[model samples]
Target: MSDRWQEMAVFVRVAESGSLSRAAREMELSQPSISRIINSLETRLGITLLLRTTRSVSLTDAGTVYLDRARNLLAEMEEAEQAARGVDSLHGVIRLAMPVVYGTRAVIPALATFMGRNPDLRVEIIITDARQNLIVDGVDVAIRLGVGQLDDSTFGARKLAVVERMVVAAPEYLLKHGTPTTPGELASHDCIIQQGAFGRESWRFVRNKTVTSVRVSARLWTNSGAGVTAAALAGLGIALATPLMAEDELRSGRLVRLLEPYQLPPAEVWAVFPAGPKPSAKVRAIVDHLAMSLGEKT
Candidate 1:
C-alpha cells in the first residue's frame, strides 16, 4: 500500500508554500524527494493536483477541492491523536496573519499575553497590510480590518471589534494652516494619503444622515502606517489613520483630531480561519483571548 499520509503531508506543505524548494527546505527533505512523492501521489490518484510553472505553483480546480477535504482529514487525524493522549493543552506552532500597523500596536500585546498563558504553544505572525492567501500560506488565523463586511464566505469569520478612522494633523501643522472645520475645506489642505493595500485618495464623513466624500490632494504618499503617522508628526501634512495608529500621538497632544462633528465609517476587525474543518483548540483559544481583550479597547 502507498504511504498515503506521507504523500498528503508533502503535497499540503508544497501547496501552502507555493514553491517546491521552499517546502522542501521547511520539511527538511531533498527537493527531488518531495517532487517524487508528489508525482507518485498524482499518478496513484490519476489526477493532477498542482499546476507548476517555472516561477510559481498553483492548484488545479480538482486540487482546490481536494485541499479542503485534505485539511478536514488532517484536522480530524490530529484531533484523534490528541484525544487518545488525554491532553487538551494547546501546543505546536500556530501561524497567524495580520496587517503590519494594527498587528504591531494591538495584536502583538494580546499575543504576548496569550503566549504567556500557553507555555507549549509557539506563534509565527506574518505582518502585511495586504490580504494574504490564507490556505496557500498555511495561516492558522487571520485578523482583517475593513470598512464593509468582508465578501469572502470561504473562511469562518468572527467579528472581534470595530475601529474608526481618525483625520489628524500635527499640532504645528494645525497651528500653521489652521484646522479644517468642514469637509469642503479639506481640499485646500495638504493631505497625506496612504498608497498601498488600504490606500485611499478620498475620505468620507457622515453627520445627521448625510455622507460626504472629499477628494484631497497629496504631496506625500506612503504604503506604511508608521510612515504616515511619522510624516504627520514631523509637520509634513495632515494624515488619515486608524485610532490605534494615532492613539499615542493624540494622547500626547502631538496630533489633533479634526472635523469632530463628522463620523468616519467604522472598520470591523475580524478573526478568520479556513472553513473546511472545525477550528483546532489552539485556534479557538487564541481567538477567544483576542476577542475578549481587543474588544474592550477598540
Candidate 2:
C-alpha cells in the first residue's frame, strides 16, 4: 500500500508534466526509476496507463480515469498531514483566474464580503478571457464558464451556475435598426462579438424541438465582454452576452433583449481546482462560499 501511494504520485507527476523525464526531474528521481515504478503500478493494477513512444507519452483512457482518483487520494493525504500539524490557520494566498466581466461584476462584488470574513486568507485574481493552464500558472483555483472539459483525474470542478446568453441591443439602437425577431435576422444587423474563450461565433439555439446553429460574422470584435457590452450600450450594434454581465444594462433598460422567442444553450459557470486526495480547509472553504454565494445570483 505504501509503494502504491508512491507509484500513484509518480504517475500523477508524469500525467501533469506530459513527460517522464520532466516528472523525474520534478520528483528528484532518475527517469529509469520513474519508468520502473510506473510499470510496476501497471502490473499491480492490471491496466495499461501510458502509451509511451520515444518522442512522447500520453495517458490511455484507463490512465485518465485512475489519475483523477489518485489526485483525490494525494490531496486527502496532504490535508491529513496539515491537520495533524495543527496548521488550521488559513493564511495562504489563493491565486484564481477568471473572465474579466465575471471577475468585475460577479466575483469582485462577492469577494469584499468573503475577504472581510477571512482576514488570514488573501486572494489574487487574474482576470482574462484566455483559458490559462492552472498548473503552469500556479493558480490555486479557476472560475470558468461553459461545460468544463478539464479531465476529472487532473482537476475537480463544481458547477456554480448556469449562465444564459441573451441577444441585447440598446433601446435606441433597437428602435433605429429594428429588433431581430428571429435568429436569421441577425445577419442583417451589425453584431458586436466577444471572440475569445466563449466562442461566440458558433452560437446554438433550440426551436421546435430541433437544435440549430448559426455562424455569425461580426463587424467589431473584442476579447473583453465589457467592451462588447459598451458597444451595444452605445447603440452601435447587437451583442450576445451573458445575463450576469448585462444585468445592469438589462435592468436599466439601456440594453433590451432581442429575439426573445429563441432559446440559446446556457453556459455553466464552474469553480475548479486541481484534483487531489483532500483539499485544504482554506480551499474547501473558499469553494463552498463561492458556490453558495455566486450560485444564487448567477
Candidate 3:
C-alpha cells in the first residue's frame, strides 16, 4: 500500500480546495499524482469518496464522514510534528469569522498584539453580521455574539465576553425630549430600533430579577448596529445598544444611558470551532488571546 499519510493529506487538500487542479497546485504536486493518490485511497478503502463533474467536485456521504475524521487525523499529525519541533514554532493560516462591529473595533486591535507574538502565522478575518457555516466556509474559528444558536455538535465553544445592552440617546436629543426614567415612559419617545440577525421588535428588560418585554415602535429602523449608533448620535432618537458599540460615546458624554434601573439582556460572545482531539496551535492562540482581551475589557 502507498503512504497512507500522503493519501490522507491529498484527500484533505482536494476536499478543501474543491477541485483537483486547485488542490494539486496548493500541494505543489502534479494533477495526475493528486488524482492517482485519491483513486488509490478510494480503491483500497472500497469506497467512492468524491463525486466529480465538469464544474465542481463534491463529497459523497461516506466522503463527508471520512473527511471529518481525516481532518482530525491530519490536525493531530500536524500537532505531533509541531510538538516535536516545539509548540512555539508551529505556524499556518487561521481563517476566522466575526461580526463586523466587533471585528473592526475589538478583534482587529487585539490581533495586532497576537500577530506581534506569532510572526509566522497569518490570519484571514471575514467580517459580517451573518453567521457562517464554519465547515462549508472553511473557517477555522468564529467569534459569535449572543448565545451561539448554530448547531455545533461537532464543535467546541469558549465564552469570550458578555456585552450588556444599554438604552442610549444623544445629549442633544435627551436635552430636547427629556430622558425616560422608566421602560413604560419610552412609549412617548422616538426610538431608533434594530431589525437584524438578532431579532425584530422584541426588546427585553429586567428589574429586580423580573423581566419584561417591550415592543417599541421605531421612528427610524436599521439593520446595521453602526447605522443605528450614527442615527442616535445625530440626535434622531433613543437607541438600545450594546456597551461595546457605544463605549466611546458613553465615555465622551456624546451619548447618555437612560432607564438605568431596568436592565437589558446581556449578549454573550463566544469563540467557536470544530471539535478535534487537538486544536491547531494558531486556533488555540487566537481564542485564548481574544478571551483574555475581552475578559479584561469586561
Candidate 4:
C-alpha cells in the first residue's frame, strides 16, 4: 500500500507505547524518524491522532476509533499471511454455491466431514440452481451439474461425479397405463419436466452403443428436481432424475425405475471456480475430499 501498512504499524506502536522514544527503541528506529511517520500519517488522514505534550502523549477521539479498526485489519492480514505461508493453511472462509437438492442430499453432509478435519476453516454455503457469477457473488467455489452447463462457463472445473439417471413413475400411474417395454413407447405417455434438470422436451437413452431421443408430452413443468419427484410421486407422469432426488420414495416402492434395458446419460458434477488465480490450498483440499467422498456414497 505504498508503505501505508508500515505507517500504520508505526502509528500503532507509538500509540500503544505513548512515547516516540519507546516506540523507536521497540522498532529499532530513531525517535525523530518515528515522529515523522506519525506526523505524515495524521496529515494524510486529515485527522489529529495524538495530543502531544512535552512529557506525555494521549489519543484524540478519532485516533481511538481508528486504532480499534486498524488492529482488526492487521490481525486479519496476519491470519491471511499465515495461511499463505502454509502454517495451518485452511484458515479462511470459503463461500460455496450449489444446486439445492444435490447440495442438501449430497454435498453438505460431505462438507461437514471436511470441516471436521480442518477446524480452522469456515464455510458459507449458498444453495441455488441458477448459474452464478462467481466474482459478482464473491463465491470462492461452486458445485455444478451437467457437462452442457459448463461448456460456456468462464470458470474452470474438475469432474467430481457422474450421476446416473433413470425414468421413473409412481406405481399408481404405471398401474393405470401399462408399463412400456421400450424407450420408443414413451412417445404416448405424459412426462413431468424438471425444466432444466435434463433439458427440454426430449429425453435421450443409450443402449449397446446406440443412442436414441424421444419427445414426450409434458404433463407438468417445474424448475426444481425436488418438484419433479413430487409430481412423479403424485402419479402425475413419468420423470427423469437421479436416484438421490427421490431416494426415499424409490426405496419405499412409491416410485419405480423404468426402462431397464436403456440408460440416460449420466449427469456430470464439477467443482468450478472463477477464471483467475489458481485455487487456494483450502479450496483444492475440499475438492479432493468431495471427489472421493461423494463418488463413493452418491
TM-score winner among the candidates? 1
For each candidate, the alpha-carbon lDDT, in order, equals 0.83, 0.78, 0.80, 0.80
The reply for model 3, stretches above 4 Å from the true place, is 1-3, 13-46, 52-57, 147-154, 171-178, 187-190, 193-197, 218-221, 276-278
Output the TM-score of candidate 1. 0.87
Instruction: Assess every candidate by TM-score.
Output: 0.87, 0.67, 0.81, 0.70
Candidate 2: RMSD to truth: 6.6
Better of 1 and 3 by TM-score: 1
- Clash number for candidate 2: 10
N/CA/C clash count, model 1: 0
What are the per-residue Cα lDDT tens digits for candidate 2 across 142-188? 88876335444457777777777888899898889887777877778
Candidate 1, residues 1-298, lDDT tens digits: the string is 3388878878877887788887787677999999999999999999999999887689999888887777667677767766776644566778899988899989999887888777788898999877788766778799988776676677788989888887899989988998899988999999997765346777889999999999888989887778889999999988888988898899999999988899988878999887433776678788999999899997
The TM-score, computed over Cα atoms with residue i paired to residue i, of candidate 3 is: 0.81
Ranking by lDDT: 1, 3, 4, 2
Off by over 4 Å in 1: 151-153, 196-198, 275-281
lDDT score of residue 235 within candidate 4: 93
lDDT (10s digit) by residue, model 3, range 1-298: 2399999888977776578887776567899999899999999999999898875568999998998898888788777877897767447677889887877988889888788877888787888877786755667788877633645656878888887788999999988998888887777888897654455455678999988877776789876678878999999998988877798999999999998889887778888886453566678778989999987877
Give the best candidate by lDDT.
Answer: 1
